[model samples]
Target: MDGTRDPLARDERAELHWLRAENTLLRVQLDILTDIATGYAHDVDTILRLRADR
Candidate 1:
């Protein structure tokens, strides 16, 4: 109900946005791993040979 509270609200929104992005990335990673685990040799090989920049 004051200007002081605005900064905290902004920080919370930024954190929530970051968390959502991370969650989406993790879900995709899990899906890829699941595919590889389910006998997808191409996916397995691709993962094995991947040179992740980060």
Candidate 2:
């Protein structure tokens, strides 16, 4: 076994963990934005429908 290979393996594992954390954070942010957009659309639709009824 090569002694120098252990550090590379450790670095890869660390990088993988960081990438996963970043992905999770980005996904949560995306969900929040989606929720905001959906709410806005609902509000707009409501306003439009109310105006149409008048």
User: Local error of candidate 2 at 26, Å?
Assistant: 1.1
In the range 26-50, model 1's lDDT, one tens digit per residue, is 9999999988777777777678778
When summed lDDT is taken over every stretch of 10 residues in candidate 1, the lowest stretch is: 1-10
Write candidate 2's Cα lDDT for 1-54 as tens digits.
665654458889899999999999999999999999999999999999999999
Best by TM-score: 2
Report RMSD (Å) for each prediction in the order shown.
11.5, 4.8
Clash statistics: count for each candidate: 0, 0
Worst 10 residues of 2 by lDDT: 1-10
**Which ranges of candidate 1 are over 4 A from the true structure?**
1-8, 40-54
